[model samples]
Target: MKFLIVFVALFALALAAPSDKDTVIVEQNSEVLPDGYTANLKLSDGTDIESSGKLEKAGTDEEALEVQGKYTYADPEGKVHTINYRAGVDGFQPQGEDIPVAPVA
Candidate 1:
């Protein structure tokens, strides 16, 4: 019984562990500063992400960090999807082909 339990637990852990064969980083670059930073990443699985963040309204009561980024990935159906987004005081805003548009009244 002890051996069986150990085997099952090990099997479960193996299943939960991340598999490196499915994903790989093809390229990555980053630059960080006191007030801003930028990052770009490309994956072997046809996924790419680029983003930047800056301290906007610095030293103000409403000071906030603004983030702008874009990401592209392939779906299960092999369709490539891209999203452009911004996040900050105005909240997160994203634009993409797969994103549904709000019906204008």
Candidate 2:
């Protein structure tokens, strides 16, 4: 009785959940090699991302992957934003209009 009612309620809620059918990948491209890789994606939701990584200082003790990429997306407020970034020994550094800047002393 009680258990049956709970099961039915849970089933109903599950059916009401939103589906991701609308958020499809409109375009995608990628390539990989022994030293590096690249990727790009565009989604129906108006999000785009492009990235690539290269082996830097290869065959050396300081060898590392240097990555560079950018992404653009729209916020819930309907405002579109773009960000460019790099990652490597220096760490992930991102630049965008929405990113805050520290006030100079």
Candidate 3:
């Protein structure tokens, strides 16, 4: 019936609609290099994620990215964790608590 078809179409559209509850929410206010940004995402299954990044330079008048600063959130076994990382010509270096990693054999 026509009513049945309309109902099915509406249902399909609702399911396909974009929703933050089911997808990650991005919060960036930068449009150029050497800018900072942060992101907060909530998963459908009740997971909270927070991250941030920014560009840094050794000195002014620098052209390209040299050192990258970053931070991320991790929840391991219901324990909250914070991680900080940096990357450049040297290499990507990460420093944080060992709580995220379990004892390795």
Counting clashing residue pairs in each candidate, in order, gives 0, 0, 0
Candidate 2, 58: how far from true, in Å? Answer: 1.1
Candidates' C-alpha lDDT: 0.70, 0.70, 0.41
TM-score of each: 0.77, 0.76, 0.39
User: How far off is residue 105 in model 1, in Å?
Assistant: 2.0
lDDT (Cα, tens digit) per residue for candidate 3, span 74-95 = 3435564554555445565666
What's the C-alpha lDDT at position 57 in model 3? Answer: 54
Please, what are the lDDT tens digits per residue for candidate 1 over residues 2-88?
232243335323422344457767787877776767777777777777777788777789777787888887766789999898877
Candidate 2, residue 44: lDDT: 76
Candidate 2 TM-score, C-alpha based? 0.76
Q: Name the runs in model 3 displaced over 4 angstroms.
A: 1-23, 34-64, 99-105
Select the stronger candidate by TM-score from 2 and 3.
2
> Which regions of candidate 1 deviate over 4 angstroms?
1-21
Worst window of 10 by summed lDDT in candidate 2 = 1-10
